[model samples]
Target chain A: MKTIFFTGKGGVGKSTLSAAAAWQLAESGKRVLAISFDPAHNLGDIFGRTLGHKVTRFSANLDLRETDLDEAAAEYIRRNTSILTEVYSYTKAFNLDRYFKVLRHSPGVEEYAALTALEDLLRTSDDYDVVVIDTPPTGLTLRILALPRISITWVDRLRRIRRDILDKRHTVHSITGTFSEEGQKLAYEEKDDRVMQKLTELFDRYVAVARHLESDANRVAVVFNPDYLSLRESQRILDGLSDLNLGVNVAFNNKYTQGLSEIADSMERELFDGRDAPPPVHRIPWEPYRREKSYEISYDLTQLFAL
Target chain B: MSEHQPNFLIRLWRSLRAFLRGIDQAQRERVVALTAYEARELENMFVLMLLGSFAGMPSPPSFLAVELLPHLEHEIRVLNRRAESSTDALAEIMGTIDADA
Candidate 1:
């Protein structure tokens, strides 16, 4: 199975390409899932159908879904909040609820939820041969990408801290019934594991899913529009994604062209199709029907999506 | 946790710290999209994934049942409710593509 993670700065037509690719793949007898992890979901518009949380039938073998992070973070929080009960009270003592209200706005929190969704989808959704993800805007998308590594480091540190704190005991057995130093150690030990436990889960999922992308066979594609700044941003992201050791395939969606005909020609020759030059580019050119954002229901999108 | 790498707990602690620093302009700003300046964070994410490293593995992730479905249900509910309020169902259907993102 291959995972095509189409991520870049938002509004560069990531969903448009992912939906079209899944449509194309499904038409060719491969089971396909066009999943959107963007906070602002837009696949419904491109595919002429609403993409809900659960996989909805878009075609004979194609399904669509948009991941929700708010609920993911809440679930992760529900299990891990116990470890932070002491600190929760401490935070409340300092009026941290005001901040919790605001931390909801953090880029990291949303990305965590998105990554959790990605991990689950990649692992559990075995029905599909291909899972095409339409990612969020660049900044948050990058955060989600780095989350696996940062999370692993965090969990490792937590385990080490727990071990260090446990190793510093002066006396194992205590005389007091309720006030024993041993009792305190036991309490902290459990609390520490509680914290480390979730961290470990997060780290594991991130690493496994990330490695799957590193393979050339997985064919992780970076989708982009033909704008200069967006193309530049895509190059930078390509360099960054390369650093992540994830196998990447590049697609320049020459979707819209008002005045840059020659540039598109050059891009197709040198970057996308490479008819005359290099061959890394797997160009999914823009279809004439997709020029208008508003779409009519097509009986068969396979013909519609033909490059 | 130790004074080392940032995890959910550490980020939470930092969140609290930011909260305490004041409910001012700085606190209001949480995410600065590194996508614009540099790709350090993005590279880091892939590096971790590439390593196939992790300690805790839950039997199955809690995300599938809880977050993904519930959020979709909510969105659908909201959208349906909005649709019901409209007298011209045809117009709503025609215009919803542009209305809801």
Candidate 2:
């Protein structure tokens, strides 16, 4: 299955383009799932449906979802705390709840939570032919995308230290004869140490997600308007995605203006002024009906996305 | 009365066995102390490396940090003790290296 991520500056209409693409892909009989990773979700507003944390069927071939990061983060914390209590029952002296409260306000919690949510979605992505993601605005989306690699490296270091702890525990068990045969088995078996096992699971999952993202099955579409600010943001998004090895498959120049043709052309030129020209750019002209209550992607716009 | 007063040879052998048992116990105690000390040092190093971010050193990712925090109360307490005794900080670092090696 292929994954398509749409990312750009705020108000650049990435959601609109994402919705149109997913809708069209489904029309062509592909099993598609459209997800909104944006905290301020407008994908549901664009589709005129009340979407929540659950996947809502838009059609037989298309599914829609809007992630609730707060809920997902809370659930993640809860699960982690329970696992900690169960696996390391000897650490009951620690006020884990207090530390969890501190973590709730710590930096990078949101991105980690979002990654947790994304991992959940991608785990079930094999059921579809394509997954369209309407990512959060520029900065946060970039951080979220870079998280998997960062997390894997962090875990690798941690696993090394954990191994040392287990070795010490095994020595203590042998010297003191403190534990039963089963207890010794759990402590001495590197694979049975709960912390090491969890870290390995987390590391492997991140590696899988990262590999899936960098594979040919994934496509990233950089959406931007024909203005200097949007164009500048697009460059950063393109560079960020390339850094992660997720090459930009296409570029969408939405809301094109014919009367200000020179301004648009000059901005586009300056956007890629010092770099190689990007992938095929599709320009969609301004439509009057886009401002209405329920916006519809015209057949012409749908056809453009098909390319 | 005659049964109670075993032979002199039997009494000598019993005393010798008692002496040997005492020496064995003393040696065992020293071995136990050394292993316990090594185990404590290893546990401390593991905690310091994993939870260093809480002590203002950049450690692992926050999610991992939070997950491991419950098991880290002892480490945090040790860190507080080390931080309180700033003069011993250098000695503590040296000690960890010596123990690890």
Candidate 3:
């Protein structure tokens, strides 16, 4: 799928830009899914409807969803716990609630939750010609963008360890009678062992996501206000994406008004610092009166289509 | 004793069966011992990965660890024993007797 991610500092007009792009893509008869990972979602307000965690049809050929992180997190935990409970019923004595509490505070919970949601979309996105993601502000956006690569490595190591353990267990089990207690427990059938199976599934899922994001079909557009702070944040985002080998094309200078163009010219110059200027800068016109009608407001954002 | 004596063929067949059964029993015992040895090593390795956090090695994500915790109770017990013992850590896990310890 052709994926375009819109991100910037708070109030950089990313959601608006993403909505516009989704609308334009749909108008051109391409199936489009525009999703908001921003906690403070304005996509719903733009579409003038409350979007839940599920995909909501915005118009013909267009769909939108604002991911509810808490809902997503709970669902992620519930799904994992159920699978774990089934595979390792013996964990019942370990005060699982305490461990789950630890998971709640785990450093990368939000990132993993977001990644889980993204992987779900990618797996099912064959129906869409393009998927446009409206991400959270600078810091969280960068973290979420980097999540797949980090997670893949983490899971890969776990898989190797699990495989070795299983291999040993298999050798032991074949020698022991299958009816023996330890033999039964050590049964390491790759097809039957759900714990190992889960690891393998996660490993494959993470790898697929990492590869997809790194592929040329995926592009990131950093939305920034013409202000120095937004520009600086965009630079960090650019560097972060480059580190992941993700493509960043077209920085959108949004909410243009009152000689902001002049500010953008100097800011862009300072930001790029003689490196090949990051993607061409696209100037979006200021439309205060039509602010409520974000879809219409963003229709003029056709420059993104060229990207 | 002469009245109870079996045919020569039948007596020979019974003697061969008993001898083969003895050999099968010995082979089965050896296989079971070898398997038990390998199984212990695998079980220890699995425990190390899942509960590595307890040993100060970074574990898989806490959520994953939590999920695997139930299946790892036995491993955890073994780990606890190993931790409490003054025995060499490597020897304890590999199921080899430490002569010095």
Candidate 4:
């Protein structure tokens, strides 16, 4: 009942859909928040207001947060900075802090932080009755989306390594398994467990994120242009989400009018019917008004609500 | 100064010992096993070391971080630009609840 997500290739109006959804929910007298967790901060520019990392209310009931992924990633690192010093002689071989700074810019760092933001919002915040996520483009969004399973797989491998280390250490100390590695094994186990726990926790956490978005209790809508290719791509994404066990309750936004608007195509009429071979594609047709700003969607919200 | 270095095996063993000690109890077995995977998890191991090193300081554990962060920042600036393909219009997304609402 509390979550939704709008993601597609960038420039497909994900931010716009998120804003409209927040506006609609707020207008309905529900507490709502729209989040743009993309590394890009276009949501602020789209909403015509800059937002801090935390919730900053844009209207009476709608709050907007455009999490700066770098800052969020730093904060995530800060949370566990304590354990880093106690266990490893990190300062000896290299400047550990400097190393992390470099690692943060590595290929997938932004997605890592962006997923962390979603984790923070879902776990920490209770300020909204509905939450809408404006994700990055398709490729990056998939990286973020697939992170849970990816991290889980990493943990499984880490666990195997821990077991092997135990086995080898035990073999080395056959005479005194209890006396020899007992101390060192326990210490190493605790630290390795901590890492595994961190990663596994995220796996469960992403499930909650996906489940909340998929729930029929809340609403989820896919926003795409009225083109055959766009609809096909959206369906592919929908299939991917389904593979992850997430549901798309309703597909909306990208409203068009009669007689050749910029994006409207004849295939939209058939796609809206959702009666092709696959069957059971949730198709909500386009509404009349399409505006640049989220606030402008309130008038259209009433009409949408009726539909 | 001696041109000859310590025996490769001795040096490798010492580093292995140090790396093992840096890891946690439960992770030790994995670390040892993944010692073979040094080529693969080296970056990850290094990250683990850094986070462990900078455990509880106000600033980064090393001054080198300041230099590294700026270099990374410069790279990100360059990358973010090349990454931006088209000036896509930013749009708003929101919704009314299901009739269940």
Candidate 5:
């Protein structure tokens, strides 16, 4: 399945643009799942429905979800804590439960949770032809985008450390003819080491996430208004994605007006500099009167995102 | 002569063999302890890398570290003990020497 991410500064019409894109894709008879990862969720509001963490069917071909980032973070910690408890039942004496309770409030947990949620959606989205993500503001969205690659480096070092520890244990075991101490059986080989196995599993997961983010199946689009702050933030978003060796597939100049054409052209020049073939820039004209339904405005923008 | 007693040369030979075996066993135990200590030191380094953020050092992300917590029972136990006895200077010195050895 192809994955598309819509990100920009707050109140830059990301939810509207991504919602429109999803509606357009679904209208074209393609199965689509549009998810909102913003903590301040408005995708459901735009759709005129109350959506939650659960997937809701907005139409015959479209599914909608607004991820609860707080709940996602909590669930991520709880799931890993349960796994730790299950594997090391004897660690109760160390008060790991209390320690994990503190982990819920730890830094970067939200970003990690967001990454995992995206990973899950991507992994299980085979039934859908396209998945569009409405992400949080620039900072959090950039961190989430960069997480997979950053995490892969740490996981790689951890795997090496685990291997060294296993090698030392093997040496000790060979000399002592014993691998158990204080009723705990230590693994001296890579295959038998649970820590090594966990590290390898995490390494593979990080690698998969990194590959998915950098692959052709993924597309990123930046949504912004033709204003100074929005243009600057959009440039930052472009630079951030470039730092991660990823490119934007499109740019949505939302609320475009004739007066702001000069500013918009400058933004395009700055954001797409040094590129031989820059992605197309689609401008959504300003509406004189607000429409009762989002589809009314989205109808024209559909062809811009045609598959 | 007592019925339990052996001849003088046989008794001397048996005593000598027993003495050598005692020294050999002691050397074997020392080697075992040293290897075990080295292995433990390596394990400590591994745990430190994972949990270094708590020590004001850069470390792996907590989500990843927490997943390996199950297999870190021994390291955690050692950390708890170290924390409890951290103020003991003599013990710390002895530990340093033991680690160095």
Candidate 6:
């Protein structure tokens, strides 16, 4: 399945553009799922429907979902907390529940949850022909996109440390025995250790997501208005993606008007001139009369993006 | 018939064998202690990597680390024990000497 991600600074019309892309792809007879990763979701509003964490049907072949990052973080912590409590019952005395309550609000939890949500959808979305993602603001989106690479490195080092630990355990077992004085079994092999297995699985998942982000099937686009601030932020987004070795497939110059025509030209030049091979810029004209009707905007966007 | 006794050569061989067996047992015990200590140290390092955020080091996300918390009960206890003894330099030195001994 092809995946398209739309990202930029807040208020750059990423949601509207991504929704239009999904609508257009679905209208063309391809099954599509459009997901909004921003906390302030407007994909549902654009489609004139109330969307939530679950997939909601919008059209014959289009499905929409608006992720609640806070809820996603909670769900991730809740699921893992149950497993931890179940296996480490002795830790109850330490009041791990309280510790987990604190962890629910820890830094990076939301970004990790966003990555997990994306990974889950990608894995389970085999029925769809295309998946269009409307990402959060620049900072959050970049963190989510960069997570898989960072996580893969961490998991690799962890696996190596785990192997060293297991080898030491094997040596200890050979000298003594594989069981403690209380008859508790000791794991000296990778296959027998749950932590090692978990680390391996995590490593594979990170690698898969990293490959997905860097694969040819994925297309990333930056959306921005014809203004200085928006242009600067869009450049930052492009630079961040470049650092991750991912290229922008297209750029949408949204809300273009005659008054800013000259500014738009210079901004476009400034945005892509120095790049080795710049992506084609698609200018979306501002429609003052149709501003209230997102359907009309999307209808126009459908034709524009088709080119 | 009078009770027969073991010959002096057989007695000597048995005593020698017992002495060698005692030395082998002591050596095995020493090796076991040393290896176990090494294993514990490695485990501590592994736990640190997983929970490095606690020490202000870059660590894996908490959600990922939480999944492996079940298998880390032993390591957690070891960590706690070390933490309690860490403040006492004399005790740590004594522990090192005792383990070597």
| Top candidate, metric DockQ | 6
For residues A35-58, write the lDDT of model 2, one tens digit per residue: 998888888998889999888998
| Candidate 3 C-alpha error for residue A61, in Å | 2.1
CA lDDT of every candidate: 0.54, 0.75, 0.73, 0.54, 0.81, 0.82
Q: Rank the candidates by DockQ, best first.
A: 6, 5, 3, 2, 4, 1
Q: Which ten contiguous residues of candidate 1 chain A have the minimum total lDDT?
A: A170-179
lDDT of 5 by residue, A243-273 (tens): 9998888888888989989998987787677
Identify the leading candidate in terms of lDDT: 6
Local lDDT at B52 for model 3: 76
In candidate 3, what are the lDDT values of residues A79-111, reduced to their tens digit? 766765665556677756345445665666777
Model 3, span B2-99: residue lDDT tens: 65566766788898999998888767655655555455555666677766776788766554566566556556665665556636655543444323
Q: How well does candidate 1 match the true structure in TM-score terms?
A: 0.58
Estimate the TM-score for candidate 2: 0.79
Model 2 CA RMSD to the hidden true structure, in angstroms: 5.7
lDDT by residue (A194-233, candidate 4, tens digit) is 4335535544776676555445544445667666666776
Better structure of 5 and 6 per lDDT: 6
lDDT of candidate 1 vs native?
A: 0.54
Native contacts kept (model 1): 0.00
The regions of model 3 sitting more than 4 angstroms off are: A82-102, A173-183, A274-277, A289-291, A298-300, A303-307, B1-45, B67-74, B86-101
Weakest ten-residue segment in model 5 chain A by summed lDDT: A298-307
Error of 3 at A214 (Å): 1.1
Candidate ranking (TM-score, best to worst): 6, 5, 3, 2, 4, 1
**Candidate 1 vs candidate 2: which has greater lDDT?**
2
